[model samples]
Target: MNTATIDTSPIRILRRPEVEKRIGLGRSTIYLHMQQGTFPKPIRLGSGGAAAVGWLEHEIDAWLHEQVSKSRVSSTRA
Candidate 1:
């Protein structure tokens, strides 16, 4: 008998364009949020001095959910 295993981990690297499209935010906004410590920091791809970077898909999803939750809480308080 043979068994197949499924990778259940949510690990996925998303580049800048995809991340911006998914989150509906532009490059500057993303970086601004990062500087404010409110967004996920991207991982540097390849060697040093390269401008390539990527963010984990799961982290972005989590950030999206957090934004929704914050809005809901604020609305309820009003």
Candidate 2:
């Protein structure tokens, strides 16, 4: 493996509070979007007895970008 050629982007995990803070959406809204297949689903963590969930930072960033693009397009049309 060529270390210099490898992709080195860090995998950041964002919990519900952080995700909501970054996206400016509440917990129920986020879950609603997820259920509607309009948002990226979280990655489940921890064991069988104690499970946790988090979203990939990159995925959330991508979703944000898409929203921005849509907003720009809509505004330009208006």
lDDT score for residue 27 of model 1: 98
Model 2 ranges with Cα > 4 A deviation: 1-6
The residue-by-residue lDDT of candidate 1 on 1-78, one tens digit each, is 658888887678999999999999999999999999999999988887976999999899999999999999999999
lDDT of 2 by residue, 1-78 (tens): 655786678899999999999999999999999999999999988877569999999999999999999999999999
Angstrom error of the Cα, residue 48, model 1: value is 1.9
Q: List lDDT for all candidates, in order.
A: 0.95, 0.95
Give the count of colliding residue pairs in each prediction.
Answer: 0, 0
Model 1, residue pairs in steric clash: none
TM-score, cand. 1: 0.84
